[model samples]
Target: MPQTIPKKKVRKPQKVGKAQKGKEEKMQPMPVYEKEKIPFRLRDKVAIITGGDSGIGRAIAIAFAKEGADVVICYEKDDVDAKITASEIEKNGRKYLLIGGDVSRENHCQKIIDRTIKTFGKIDVLINNAAVQTPQDELKKISAQQLTRTFEVNIFSQFYMSKAVEKYLKKGSSIINTTSVTAYRGSGHLLDYSATKGAILAFTRSLSSYFSEKGIRVNAVSPGPIWTPLIPTTFDAEEVATFGSNVPMKRAGQPVEVAYAYVFLASDDAAYITGQVIHPNGGEIVNG
Candidate 1:
């Protein structure tokens, strides 16, 4: 009878999947999903959003559409993602125009504005939100070409876009630039990117003052670590996984959360707000 006793089997511990951990711990998904509940504040307005194919750009495009604004989306590539944004805009009963090209080129920026005017007659809002960032641990690792390219796409594009839309923008029209939290705090790995963002903040302030007499408002939105395509594209897997863990909120901000800031800046609600920056960086306090 004693010899007939069999050894008991033990169960091994199982590893948790990233996706499973995300769900089980109620972690925010890559792109936070949300629907607009605000009233139609931007009814009949015409807006242009660069990089509108995905990420924060897509969220802002959708938010603008829901607020009753006709949207002109300028994207470099990814027709699939652009189409998705277009469909969502159309679903909101708003007119959508998709322009595919590099916004960093001055000619392309002009063409974008020209097309928007041709389609919508006037530009009410211009969002210079297209940007790129390449992480390098050491300054020496950043080549001259890479640095130049970053500036072109990040800051130079904003200049070109602003100039292109300036003549078309009427009084009370808004210009919102997407800066970054790194502008204030700085990033060792993102030196060039942070520098450009700092320039954007200065541009926002100076542009706001320059346009004040003309009744046009210029502002910027500085987002901390928002879950967007940029994170996965720029950071490694480990970095991406722990992206917003260092922030005060201990979580990445959703595009939807940042989208509202753009909406408010574009609407009459921010009539007196210009040359200012909106911090949506998950409770990270910074001198703005």
Candidate 2:
């Protein structure tokens, strides 16, 4: 039989309501997840999580550490939050590295990998979780600066980090990217952010195919509205209060809830899974 060529999957754009993203900045109704008493499945593994100072990144950092991974936490600039997160990592009896800089810069990305290798001797897992969102009411409001900054921090960082760590990654090592439901369902307010997330989706799938030949796997998690600093940083008060209500679950998800998905994909349990997106968005389903 002749070998048949595989088909490339096409992505469809999703249209959503009109709302500005800054509406979520002032909200105080924080979402919570039940993560207590779970046994550490990632124990002793070495992983890197960008933006690990707070919210989803912080939750992932703690969860990964609990599962046995020494974590390298990279943040743009949050000294106090970073120190607190670092303190917790040490308290958990795990090694920790705090890297502060703009991940959008390739040189800084290289430095991150260098520091990780020097400190841990190897990189078993890489989680690209740092991102930014700017909700614009109108398409015209999405200035070139907004689009460029969004791509630089959100999509470009992934490229740099992946290239920087490619040589260090080996068989059984997995790469997890933090994509968003906005990529799947679209966000009226977060236009550029959604677009960059869509880029991440393509990047993850393509990278998975490239590396699967070597036993390295790549996957992603498309979280809906997990409470994070980004939410408070990007949206206003009332909007934050009603966050995640539109979903079938009728509420927002917590950072820890999303972290478990990362934990699963990073561990040996997901050895057979790659190039897939795990949705933990309070039951708001997307046809993936």
Per-residue alpha-carbon lDDT of model 1 for 1-288, expressed as tens digits? 457767766666455566667564544333434546557989999999998889999999999999999999889977899999999999999999999999889999999988888887899999999999999988899999999999999999999999988888789899999999999999999999999999999999999999997899999999999999899998999998898999888999999999999999999888889999999998999986
Q: TM-score of predicted model 1?
A: 0.86
10 residues in a row with least lDDT, candidate 1: 24-33
lDDT tens readout by residue for model 2, 226-265 = 8887777788898888988988989888988888899999
Best by lDDT: 1
What C-alpha lDDT, on a 0 to 100 scale, does residue 257 get in candidate 1? 92
Cα RMSDs, all models: 21.7, 14.1
Candidate 1 ranges beyond 4 A from true positions: 1-38
Provide the lDDT at 283 for model 1. 95
